[model samples]
Target: MTRNRVLRQSKLLCAKGVFECEDLTTLNHGVFMSVKRKMSDEIKSVWSRNGANSYKEARDVVHRVEWEDYQHWLDLQWPKK
Candidate 1:
């Protein structure tokens, strides 16, 4: 999605009292789960289709997920309790 959309969603979530007072541990767990799911699918796809490029593909997928997770954290507005 675009930056604007993300900002909008963040604002809406905040307004709706969804993002505020969240449990940090739960949030991190969810992010980790998301990354794990993406990595699992990506790695399996690459490993099945091509043997030679599988290593590189898996690495790229992992890096992409890590970057995305970082971006996600950056976008969040941690509400003070």
Candidate 2:
């Protein structure tokens, strides 16, 4: 599939609270790990800013931030040719 179409579908999934974005399955292991760590930090920041007392309280916002971060990493890794 075309890159833009794939990105669009993945973003739709993200909008639906899908936290993982492993669409480009061949992503380097180290890079994936790095992105995951970055996402964790973003989640923590959102959780604090929103005063979320528990994982459940931070669920929606965390998922959205996680997806957005992951998507951004994906874009950087696979910039349009």
Candidate 3:
């Protein structure tokens, strides 16, 4: 898959709260420690929001932040060769 497609799918997966480093490895077309780190951070952030006002609201916030982070990562041209 193309880089853009991989980035987009990664963002979607993050938004959906499905963070699996192994999966990201495949999406990245190879092992990418930076991407793995970002994904790990996103998951940790989301998991940290477990005691918010409502689970749904917390999930929404996590998804929004994850998408934003993904966009930032894309803008940075991550997984630099």
Using TM-score as the measure, the top candidate is 1
Each candidate's TM vs. the true structure? Answer: 0.27, 0.26, 0.20
What value does the lDDT take at residue 5 in candidate 2?
64
**Per-residue lDDT of model 2, residues 1-81, tens digit only:** 564465557657778886434333343433354444444534343221121112212245433234335456555443233
Would you list the C-alpha lDDT of every candidate in the order shown?
A: 0.41, 0.40, 0.37
lDDT of 1: 0.41
Question: 45, model 1: CA deviation in Å?
Answer: 14
In angstroms, the error of model 1 at 15 is 48
RMSD values for the candidates in order, in angstroms, are 16.1, 13.7, 13.2
> Candidate 3, clashing residue pairs?
none
**Residue-by-residue lDDT tens digits, candidate 1, 33-73:** 44444445344332111111122244454233343355563
Error of 2 at 77 (Å): 23
Q: Show model 3 residue runs off by greater than 4 Å.
A: 1-34, 37-65, 78-81
Which is superior by TM-score, 1 or 3?
1
lDDT of 3 at 47: 22
